[model samples]
Target: MSKDYLSVMPEDFSDFGLSQPILKAIDQSGYTEPTPIQTQMIPSVMEGRDVIGQAQTGTGKTAAFALPLLNGLRQKKKASPQILVLAPTRELALQVADSFKKYGTYINNLKVLAIYGGEEYSGQLRQLSKGVNIVVGTPGRVMDHIRRGSLKLDTIQSFILDEADEMLKMGFLEDVEWILEQAPQQKQIALFSATMPSSIRRIAATHLHDPVEITIRSKTATASTINQKFLITNGMNAKKEALGRILEVSETDGVLTFVRTKMQTVELAEFLTELGYQAAPLNGDIPQNQRLRTVEQLKSGKIDILVATDVAARGLDVERVSHVINFDIPFDTESYIHRIGRTGRAGRTGEAILLLAPREKSMLKSIERASRRKIEMMHMPSVNEVNKKRIEAYKSRITKTLTEDCSFFDDLIRDYCSETEASVEQVAAALAKLVQGNSPMLLEEKKYERREKRERKQPVGGRNNRRSSGRSDEGMERYRIAVGESHGVKPGNIVGAIANEVDMDSEYIGRISIYDEYSTVDLPAGMPRQLMKVLHNARINGRMMKLSREGEKSSGSERFGNRKNGGKPRRSNPKTSRKPRTASAV
Candidate 1:
């Protein structure tokens, strides 16, 4: 077929030829027009042609393959497995399976099962025994099933490799090849990959029978729909604080926050809920029923935010989700696209906010290049903005309550004024103050003080000078290390390690005093107990840290004089051998 053949949308599936129930479900799901990938690949697969689809993430790839696979399912046959879909990660596998489940829900005798690592194997085994029509899984787990003789491909009709490049990147090409070899020779092979590296092309040429090549060029296709922006922060905690501020300022109807791990899904959901957001967690650990319910609630406006791992939120269609927050940067560009695609859906304008730490800024550039669109840098909402939003929200609630129920409270207010022997104006003022207690508007003094403190605490220059005076202050812990001026230990390494491991910013780390025998670094006061333990167990330059106060007996040499000297440690050149001086000698 000509390359132009794939350029135009297919007319054959214009009607979808799906059963009435399936068509109704699709209509209810708000799918009006087919995405380019879906339009090109669905008809080819329906024709039983070995197809090669090249498209990036967020291009409706799941439906591109799922619609045809479901359309090909036989109604009267025994529920023996007929279609196999191999995906790279557990998240993608579950996502594809969910797509199949939704589209195939109306098809009788079609059972789709998703198998992947980190889940119960026996349950999958039992499901396999019961007979499944379609199986979507990661390569290694799929190979395990095949090895266990649980997944029989004897009657397989179609095999799809979704995100083939990702599977290769994850070192699953061997398992993919092995599984392909095990499948029936007559089976139709459809390979879908974001980028067709030579290796994937070789597989397509060898396995596919003169496959129709479809390439969907990446461009500013979805960029206009998505308002992409990034927030820069010192570190993770600062990112969280910025996220809270952004949420406060945003007028989002619903939000989806993408985190890296399932544990983070629960943790962030709980944190958001505690911050007075109606939030819930969506991850692999949540039961499928609950996952579906969560999505429905998000759609119905019961929950304002859904914290999810990529896997759990796949195939989720929540049209009201106006905002998508990347709580953690995705490992790959494709994942980033998919995460943001959760918003700006169905032709509705949506916003995607990314929180990037200093180190993660590089990944942002990579995503920009891959997506072929620039993500604008977004300033974090300042304290003033956050306070304004809070006050506005408070005012709106007050107006609504007063408009709806002023009669009931009028008697109570009069009684309070009479009992206190106070004028109505005075009582009303007191009531207003009580209602707006401790609001951000009232905390401007604290906010200003904190901002002033941060500005005053900027670090001074020079390695030696910084080490001497950096951390010699109240609320600093002195940590002793074996490597000092002799071992080439620098303040940056110490700061970098602590910042990376304990989620502390470099600014919070204090002075470093180097000596011939060892070095002492000052850390922030009230460091989490867990972080302190981590520091105790941490090794820098293969030397364990023995952390203690500055005046502790273990601090061998007072390279920097005690607090009395104002953290001005004696300077010594590493090239010259000088006797290490102690505090007592000074």
Candidate 2:
């Protein structure tokens, strides 16, 4: 099948018998066709069969399961919940609940409640007392409600475990199993997870009865429509400055910047606004009305930039978003995909730019691999580029006002030129200088270069001095750190920790080899034993280092024991590979 044929189209929603209101909501949300998960799972769900869905985070899985559950609800059904969804995180619960509300808009007399931690429980209790048709909640809170008798699942006809693997990882599998036991034995169960490990499969085997399995894998590892790129920065402040420079240079109609924390969403938005950009923060705390308005502003050009956390920005569709900026590198590869997906949507081409402190280069590589696309290197915009863009913007503004409000500004400019005995060209030049004064654009070239130098100077290896040691072509014994793959260590962490602990240039760090459990990096061939000991004692990822040879042992042996040895080899476990050694002797 052609790539486009395999992908979800907007028209797929038509077959679902969605009421006009729900249809309108979907259309407004920029969904035209159903995703594969939606297409295959929706029908099965509406048929009231338990479903087992395997799809990644960005595959529109929420709507896939939610729409069908809503469709199955009878208009006359009692206020007690007909469906319950258990999610791993509070943010995920809220997101799923919002999806339910949006898709069930036309389902008359339907009520949905989202219950999660860190919120007032009295309001939830009141909602429960009034009765609701659907409840989306985190595992812990749902268990609490069940214990308190505030939540009664006797009438629930459908149950869903979203992000089942995540819940398992968070040690909530016991709670999930307990909750499942509490539900009626006849209830339908739907379990969705990106990756189904043995534990997840067991849950499916025990709960779903001969369930139809649907798996949709993206043919192209990464969204081909997205242009991914990255810029290297020194630290937090330099990253902000570089972001400002990029915003000025990139030709984007609207931009969505992803950050790791809710606090960062606010702080980054504030910084952008202070720089005279139309920017706003979108987070879970923002009222629904305000969030909708912010999204509208972004689409309509009232706001040019949006800073948001991954969860808060879920289900947002703004076709005009031409660029996605990763202000903070995501915690995982899946998040990276979702963040960039905010752009390059609906067959539109978009650009995704990632800002990485010197140490984060390793994570950047992982992101590139996970997305299955090469992320191009983007040089931090130079002072000259910023200045050039500023001049262009200034001229454009002047030209627009001159044409649209000629009478208002033309005479004033003329009067000023005449009174000062200066030519109009000279007057305009002076005005331009005044307008562009003291901005990042006017910063000295040396300042930018110095900042870049500092960024490059930051440490580039792992947290501890567990340098990956290797021999150079000249037979020089080179000692480096194994801060890379072994402990999920990113280049940024390596660089930051090294620079902070030892006065060394991040650039001096040589080639790095990242393995699942450990990484081998090249550094200066010879270093004092005491310095190497200091590095070993240093912590990365909050763990001490015990460095080993890079590529010296087969990664396969480390990961899976040799079958020859009764499947229990004596070598180190790949999953627990320690840090690389700084010196060969060590």
Candidate 3:
């Protein structure tokens, strides 16, 4: 239902029957009205019904559930967790838990805890022992707590699974199912997914009962109000210069710059701050309190620029964000969408600019395909253009000062001009020069290269793709490993572990034969001593291979007892016989 951009949002939150405290919190959150997902899903969830909310990433689903859950906190009072929320990632867990705390600020005796990996257990333990009203965490960590008998779900009134589809994609479906089984039968269940695949549907069928289904799909991954553009930058130097130029010319009110790593966030923020933009770095390592403070600063216009990672910026809904600059492209299209969605939110018009290196053209194509909009190339600002912008800004500042009461500065400048033999304009020019530090007001022109052509002409195969580097065409050598059927080792397992260690392709693997207690395989001759030594400790299915060249007594035919059966045709290498189809099917 949210897909229709023409739909009118709710007039107010009172219509949803939320509590006064929640209303106050929402007011503080600056959400004047509810999004479509919130409008449709809030009332149903408030009534304590099973809900299946299907919505895209930017539909404000977190608040839709968080508000109602907090509103009913008094209905079932318990020191144990009354609400259990499962997210696919720790970052999401942190964000959702923060929201619950924000919405429940006025609700007395309310306590929430976020438990996830990459954290010390002592803090989480202390919070749980002290008593908590809600527990939000990733599935794996939740399972850990359950098995350790630290997290109890018997008193849970509400169980929420956020981003069900993401969990499924990340191979956590089984873990989710197991956790659902642990919840109390009397609890209300809510499952949310962006796209309901068969696995997620099966989960809903198995756990949720008579759920009210809600779906929100936008026409495009990004709002049409967002003007998207890309700049072809060749490397870090060019990309940095391009970023400075773009911000110099573009409308940069509350700009959010996305980078790939935590280190990049700090480095780029420092760079931008040096360039005179008030920028802050945000990443996972920052304390949660500090992170929240940083977010509030950005929201309140205390800072004009925020450089953040995808995880750090997830679920941010700041209306002041006027632009999103992708300093480093995301690994997936979903992340790309989430990154740009920081701007152009709440039906507001915004700009999104992406910097692309030559090697990232394919990723650019993927993003274009996913966003379903043509991202036109950006025009790099010339030296003359930068100078013009600087001049305009300078004149505008001077005009504003003239409008204000600057009598103190005016008298001082007049006295100085009289003492020296200088005109008023010359004195003003000298002050302007002093105000403008050593940093140049304008940037020198930098040339941009079209590296896409070179990228396209590059060949694919390299030494990394080889199964065995420097393996001569003469013949092969037979090797033996002390792992086989008895140890539950399969040919495919052997092939995978060895190939992965050397960054090789599996298709080029040679013949393999497995016995009850051991296995023999033919490999390219003249194996490097270093590679052989590394392979000695290569493990498969938790058992070290202890790999070594056969004692040179066993021939290929003698190793395979079923040679008469002729299991299968060998790899297409000219020097080999039929490769036995023992267990290398994978």
Candidate 4:
């Protein structure tokens, strides 16, 4: 127990003696009490002492250091980057900068800039030249500026390394070390990370001088307020329809749906929009200004749903986001935590629904273990459920309208009934019919069932991989590649190579078998000639994999084919043939 590193248990933000401006901003932001990290670490940071904090995601770590850094800044007329915060990703950089701005709203002439890759240099240069009080940026982009002489570090008083573990994992340790070394030696240092690996500890020991170490271990990665559930589904189209049905039935203020790829985000957003849902796509490709506007629109209720990739949705915090739909199961538990974290923020109740296939049940278990929360199995919303929800909403709308003043509408309705020589009841029924529009109120359960079945049905010889395995279905042609076990060519390798070459999902790929000298992959029929040519020259295991359809004799086969027993016919043994372990689609 070092005297300078005493533990604290503050009841509220006021206990930390934060400046009146910061306290006011916190109150306006609706935060009543400081989170554990903030309560434990803010005091030390504000006292100009070095500190190291270990906290999980969504634990309010940003505010822990941001408030203290802002309070420590002197109210000077001329500013030149007094505090430098290095974040791992662009999203985190921008988010940390936003936190600084929010907490220091009352501080005069306080300028914060977030520098990251993928943006024009002109804007960043302009901001740097104009002078900023604080600069938060990713390590690589920050190094670029430091090298270009655009960013000055001499005026820095406080240096912070946010998400140190993530920066290390992303191979930014060298750049981070370079930046850390460049900063003034006497400056106060604060390092925050979710995990404290030896490498992080080494840096902390070397840089931080008798720093107060505060560790806040969360029982689980996910928030307690989130209602986690999973719906078992199969196939891409079926999952899409199931998502639509879930969106139709759930009473959500706004939804953030997570997918695996940027292309999926755009396609799913487009599909939902076509179905009359107000939806938009958010991904790395979208410009930063547009991304900002899209988020604002989501918060303002202009968009009901957002389809986005994991990279795009990082650091996204919106209060009205009532639901998080994992349209595609996340590849890892960490990503799952981050995806669901979009909701259930600031103690708001949120719904996290995952579209899981039978094969994905194992991943669900992994997530449960990682988050330490059992995800309840949720039944798919049936047609009856959807119709009931719709009818309830319709009735609610009618009740609300009835409660409002409608004297003018009543007279118009009476006049219209008189002109048509119709009874009041008949006129009211006609009006109701007109309001419902061409879309049917009730969906046919059997119709959706039939569609799912039809989509699953394979061509005469085609076999659906989800339901069956082994042997290419009819119409799926077998192609041979010049790499196999001897060349360390695994099923994953072949699947990845073909999928990457053509932008096709691994699930869409058929069966695969590898021979000692060559391998065979089952692909959909009718591959474009140009794509085939491109894949033919594709390199795998440092060898040019020349692909050709089976039964097409190639001169290279007899010329360079591996013959195990001096060209003698090897016995075709079923057990010896390589059947691939299922490859997951990204």
lDDT by residue for model 1 (120-191), tens = 789999999988988999888898899989988998998999888767655678789999999999998888
- Candidate 3 stretches greater than 4 Å from native: 1-33, 74-78, 105-108, 117-123, 168-175, 197-199, 219-222, 285-297, 300-302, 358-369, 372-376, 399-409, 445-586
Clashes of each: 4, 27, 1, 1
Best by TM-score: 4
RMSD per prediction, one decimal?
A: 9.6, 11.5, 10.8, 7.7
Candidate 1 lDDT at 261 equals 68
Higher-TM-score candidate of 1 and 2 = 1
Where is the poorest 10-residue window by lDDT in model 1?
577-586
Superposition TM-score, candidate 2 onto the true structure: 0.69
Query: Which prediction has more favorable lDDT, 2 or 4?
Result: 4
lDDT of 2 by residue, 1-586 (tens): 0112264544658788865767777787778778667877877888888788876655678888887777667665458888999987665777788888888876678799999876778999999999899999989999999999999989989999998877865678999999999999998898888777899999888988878887766623227778989988665677789899898888989999987666778899999999899999988777755776888798789999999977677546667989999987765566677678777765678899998766567777777676667789989787888888877886788788767746867889889888988999898777777876766446588866776777677654323343333234211233334343546777666656655665444534545544444444554433333345556566778865444333343222242212355322134456887544232211
| lDDT of each residue in 1-586, candidate 4, tens digit only | 1322235556688877788998899988889877777777787898899998886777788998999888878867677999999988777888889999999988878899999998889999999999999999989999999999999899999999998977775678889889989999999999988778799999998988989888776634346989999998766767888998998898899999998767778999999999888899998889888888898999899999999987678778888999999987764566688788888877778999999866557678878887788899988788899889989988899999999999999999889988999999898888888998887878988998898688666332232333112555533567777886678877778878877875555644666665667766776554545557778888888887788886575435443345665322233457875533323222
lDDT of each: 0.73, 0.72, 0.76, 0.80
lDDT of 2 at 118: 66
TM-scores for candidates 1 onward, in order: 0.71, 0.69, 0.69, 0.79
TM-score of 3: 0.69
Candidate 1 Cα errors over 4 Å, as ranges: 1-22, 121-126, 259-274, 279-303, 306-320, 328-332, 357-363, 403-406, 418-425, 435-586
